[model samples]
Target: MSTIVFAFSIFCGWLIFDVVKHRKLTLESLVSSLVIAVVAGVFWWILDLFF
Candidate 1:
């Protein structure tokens, strides 16, 4: 479902950011991760709408 996809994207983004940033948990990474997640979710949503 779209909801699952969105949540998964968010989790993936967070995990990736955390892993790539030397495992350091910072506010900047957290914010950027959320942004990435939202963008990915919206992109997927649009694709779902069209196809």
Candidate 2:
């Protein structure tokens, strides 16, 4: 749970950075960030489970 939360926070940070750098927040960016976050969380979870 904590790991998941941490992943989410990191995602939020990335999203914010993208928005700031681009000077506009778009739906595509939001969706991509969500997708990336999910993939990263899954990868981390699997790694933690195995090692």
Best by TM-score: 2
Cα lDDT of model 2 overall? 0.86
Report the C-alpha lDDT of model 1 over 1-51, residue by residue, as the tens digit: 875678677867786868686777777777777777777877888888898
Off by over 4 Å in 1: none
lDDT of 2 by residue, 1-51 (tens): 966996798689879988998999999889888888888888888888898
Q: All candidates' lDDT scores?
A: 0.75, 0.86
- TM-score per model over all chains: 0.67, 0.83
lDDT (Cα, 0-100) at 1 in candidate 2: 93
Best candidate according to lDDT: 2
**What are the RMSDs of all candidates, in order?**
2.4, 1.2
